[model samples]
Target: MTESATDTTPADQLGSGPGRVLVWFYGVFTVAAASRSIVQMIMDFGKAPLAYVLSAIAACVYGFITYSLVRGGEKARRAALVCCAAELLFVLVVGTWTLADASAFPDATVWSDYGMGYLFIPVVLPVLGMLWLRRAKR
Candidate 1:
């Protein structure tokens, strides 16, 4: 279905209310992961390449979701939903990997121990984003 130009209701806005909160969290996570990864990758990438790289990837995913939310369209909503799913999958895989084999990650990633450093927000945020996106559907 095609969306009209004047379709600017709050329900149609992915960045409204709770979606706005999602955007805030995603934006914060983007900055946090990006900066952490950039510094780690620059200073001591060889020390824990997997962790740093995973953090960088997480940053990219968070950045994309934040952008999709702010863009506020059906296409953007779908994109955000898909990214949230991927983010959750990454969190679970990485979280479990970090726990199952500590040697694999000498250092911690943003999703390490299921975002223990960040209060598990990394795992929870994506689920909330997906729900909000579904509700904001046009």
Candidate 2:
């Protein structure tokens, strides 16, 4: 048996296969980061403004990547790739900053300690996302 070009269904897009898993992960992070930031800000913004703000930023990045992955196209894939790279950089910078100057954070951002609170998933996810996006390009 042979499959034709039309066999490419919607499920065969970037959001399918491994991309589906990536979307799920990104979606989870979006909610986690957003809610955590919101609660922290509401509870005591003055306590750790920098950490809360960073968490909010992480939430936005995660949300955008989630949307792009689900949207599924070359453009969306490229957008996701860029976001993933940015996410990785954010994690690295914030992680190092938090360590180098603990007083500046007061509390932990989503990327603090290299995502230690989240079992390092935040740090690893973007790397996996970039790789997946690259693979989907071909």
Candidate 3:
């Protein structure tokens, strides 16, 4: 009745436990940011090209992190960790820049104002992601 360690699969290892929530959040952000950026770009790229581009970049980062979390391996874990750090940095820099020079960004990006528009999920998610990733590593 005992199961062998070899019987465990990657799927069982990833997108399970606490990682399940992380994956879900990342997936949601990916879709939200991507769709928002696409719509903004189509409707009025001239209004806030920088913000829209940043939104697209954030979407890409979120998508990558979501995929890595789902993949569930050492490689994917490392990639997710790195991306989480980068995401945090982007949020901080963009947030500060937006605050200091509001005119620079006619519109807001996912990271602008530390994700105030998104209820600060974009600001907080990466910190939680990095912490979760570190815990998952062990």
The most accurate candidate by TM-score is 1
- Angstrom error of the Cα, residue 94, model 3: value is 0.3
Instruction: Indicate whether candidate 1 or candidate 2 has the larger lDDT.
Output: 1
Show pairs that collide, candidate 2: none
Kindly list the per-residue Cα lDDT of model 2 for residues 33-126, writing each as its tens digit. 9999999999999999999999999999999999998877778888899999999999999999988999998899999999999999999999
Task: Give, for candidate 3, the lowest lDDT window spanning 10 residues.
Answer: 5-14
Question: Local distance difference test, per candidate?
Answer: 0.92, 0.91, 0.91
Q: Rank the candidates by TM-score, best first.
A: 1, 3, 2
lDDT agreement of model 2 with the native: 0.91
Judge candidate 1 at residue 102 and give its lDDT: 98
The residue-by-residue lDDT of candidate 1 on 1-138, one tens digit each, is: 888897777765888887878889999999999999999999999999999999999999999999999988778888899999999999999999999999999999999999999999999999999888888884
The digit string of per-residue lDDT tens for model 3 on 1-138 reads 988855655433556888899999999999999999999999999999999999999999999999999887778888899999999999999999999999999999999999999999998999999998887777
Flag the better candidate by lDDT, 1 or 3: 1
Candidate 1, residue 98: CA error in Å?
A: 0.4
Q: Please give me the total number of clashing residue pairs in predicted model 1.
A: 0
Global CA lDDT computed for model 3: 0.91
